[model samples]
Target: METISKIELRNLQIEDYLELRASMIEAYSGIEDAPWKEHEIKKLLSIFPQGQLVVLADEKVVGCALSLIIDDKDIDDNHTYEEITGNYTFSTHNPSGDIMYGIDVFIHPKYRGLRLGRRLYDKRKELAEQLNIKAIMFAGRIPNYSKYAEEISPKQYIEKVRMKELFDPVLAFQLSNDFHVKKIMKNYLEGDTHSLDYAVLMEWNNIYYDKSPKLINSEKSIVRLGLIQWQMRPLKNLDALFEQAEFFIDAVSGYGSDFALFPELFTAPLMADYNHLNEADAIRELAKYTEPIYQKFQEFAISYNINIITGSMPNIIDGNLYNCGFLCKRDGSSEMYTKIHITPNEVAHWGMKGGDVIKTFDTDCGKIGIIICYDVEFPELSRLMADEGMQILFVPFLTDTQNGYTRVKSCAQARAIENECYVAIAGCVGNLPRVNNMDIQYAQAAVLTPSDFAFPNNGIKAEATPNTEMTLLVDVNIDLLKELHEHGSVRILKDRRTDLYEIKKK
Candidate 1:
């Protein structure tokens, strides 16, 4: 550790965040035990305006201390605490909720000899006084400073302490800042030191009182998503369609795509003309043609062991003709959704209006939803599903016009961004010679993200060839969506004028 004198101290400003983050990443380049992330820093900023205390050598930040005010009044008022059995429980009554929690302290590797970590804590204590927070509490990873020294592997340190790491630098720093170890949390992560892995909860009282909370712009959040792009054909010729579908199943399952989707009517052929066929007759024909194909698909899914969206196909339930999508999992559980939006041509040809409701369901990847062909054009349906916490919208369509396809694809992307979810569109691309001379083309596959939108960082993450039968793959992180949704960054669920929309509904 090298010693340096020209250290400047200050609170974090908005402009300083990115720079400070880049520096932290650089400083901890080779230290996995001292991992720091931008999102965590952002969360600190959101909870505390002056929570970040920085030390500058010359003009750059070389250290940081994170602290947050926890009002005893607020704490006392809350009835529950996070507990071991995965439940919240009320244990005791408190006089007030005014408390300050010291989260972490960071010092640049180059300036380790300056004892700057202590200085930052002193500043944090001073701020606690200014905020009038009556009590302070914190936790730390055991074994402290010796744990992070280059000579000591974390594994070795755990053996020395006969304990596991309860916290990191942040928790350990709290120990020297007048907080004591109160509890031990064990085996937090695999391969961590047993004794030191437990967190030592500590508390301090009567630091400060009655300070107003200020606006905080930095909040830790992430957007998670699940994407499934359907790319399979539904034709009467069972052999050829099944073959095409096998390739798709391979592409999706091979990459372990969170979910893989197929087009509407994916494994069944359309009738040349439905003029004489009753609803029952049409569906019977489809079932007769598709039963074997579906059985094979189920087997394929089991072999690959992946979630598959069996795109819409003509089905007969109680003698009613319907277009339905099937949600199939590796464990063999399956559910179906009848298309809620039927086109005029579809109704004229099949004598069906539309299905009744929308659906969102749980899957191994996360909660997902399905909106068939024309159903996607209705923004209300997508918004309803979004409001229900649907993180991925899978669409299966067959269209002829480039304009219509582009419009639907763009709508899917817009819905995804507005909802802070992922939108995946899969359309039929090959020829359907029996229907008409019309050449089918559409957004065969697309993955839209919040970053792709016009609003700063919401938009499309990936999209497939406009008119090709290729399988697209993307890794979906569903946790990120939950963060974005909770924070109201993308404002898909929030910021809506429900009152006004209600009047329009009337």
Candidate 2:
């Protein structure tokens, strides 16, 4: 047998109950008039096993610390220990509480000089910090008070302890650990002789606590989006395309959407090459109107005080043709992301070249990325965006058949799940009969989310009917994404085996 003196602190387990209960009895001795039942201890562990911890020395249980979460609003200055703890049952445990209430802590009498209590308190502080709560609050027993109960009041006795005129085994240790006395709690523990049934309220604030209430509740942090499944047709002139753009913007801006997204090549109708030019010639003609179309969308975004993702458009940059997506901010600023993955049709028929950079946009709504049509079909692109802190991805696509649309739709949902992010897709649903190579269209628009408890059942925040020309609006909570990454049922990001494999960009 190994006789080494090794100590370990860890979360309470079901099998540790017998040893833990025995340690509790030895630690409390004559002071524990109301000892905890074994079933009650099991119940506390079942409620929140993370808050209950035990310390072991040489593989033997020697100390334990039990705690429960409580809402700060429910705690008043005059609350007693029993009132806060639900008569020692810990039925008041609130998972969303802002404060961690220490229910009980004890070290076996034989293990008292080993500083085992400090290890238990340290573990509690670590747990509280991991939960991102505001503070750790508990009532401290003044064990030395039995000698002073006849000589001084609870308040006076606490003042003497604070002033260093008297020493309490518990309060003095708590004070040494940076906890401050708040107030006196009377009759905190029933039939307690050491404390005279009085306890002192003590608290230790977590200085690094997150102050944003939005993180705990999704309702407080909403990012509304307007997704437009554009209706396409042959444009009689440039004015016709401008009219359609203005209408969609006016409709969604009234509903107070932070962003309005349009479909890929939404301005393809502007080519109006009634002469029936070939695919390459028609795409080249559309490229000519890119500057004018961008100006118009920029004006619309500023006028309505809404950010606009002007889907994708054909652009001729430095004599090279590329598919580019533009984001026009309400502040009159704009950024562009070119499609890095060019489709076979684009390359073979239009001589389109793929872009070289993969980038994300930082906007008022959130960190966002744009992946055009076929770009989203590749998981690496979305993964890179997510690695860069992108919480939302906008995919603008143009599909000519139901099969093509299904490919994009299914891939979009998978990207949402794999990256734990929101994905909003928009596409053109009608055809420009007069324009060659653009006469057929099949599309749908949808706001997809990660398939997690914090999101919708099907991971679809909102979706337009397939092959329909309509607008869909939905609210996505960015804070919910933050919470999911931290405390979701499965923490994919945190659980990645970086030591075995890694993903990086050259």
Q: Evaluated with lDDT, which candidate comes out highest?
A: 2
Evaluated against the true structure, the overall lDDT of model 2 is 0.84
Which residue pairs does candidate 2 place in steric collision?
Answer: none
Cα lDDT tens digits, model 1, 1-506, are 44332345688765666667766776656445444455555555565667678877656777776665554444322121233111211222122346666555567677664446766765666665665556666554454634455577554543444343444544544554566554544443223342234444566655334456543222212222223333323344657676767776766654535466777765434444431466445545765555465566555554455567777777667777778767766444567788887888777656564678676888655677888978888887877777676877888776768887877877877777666777777776765544432225455577777762232353666667666657777655565676676664445577778877731221
TM agreement with the true structure for every prediction: 0.50, 0.57
- Candidate 2 lDDT at 45 equals 86
Clashes of 2: 0
- Model 1 worst lDDT window (10 residues): 84-93
Each prediction's Cα RMSD?
19.1, 21.0
The lDDT per prediction is 0.60, 0.84
Best by TM-score: 2
Report model 2's TM-score to 2 decimal places. Answer: 0.57
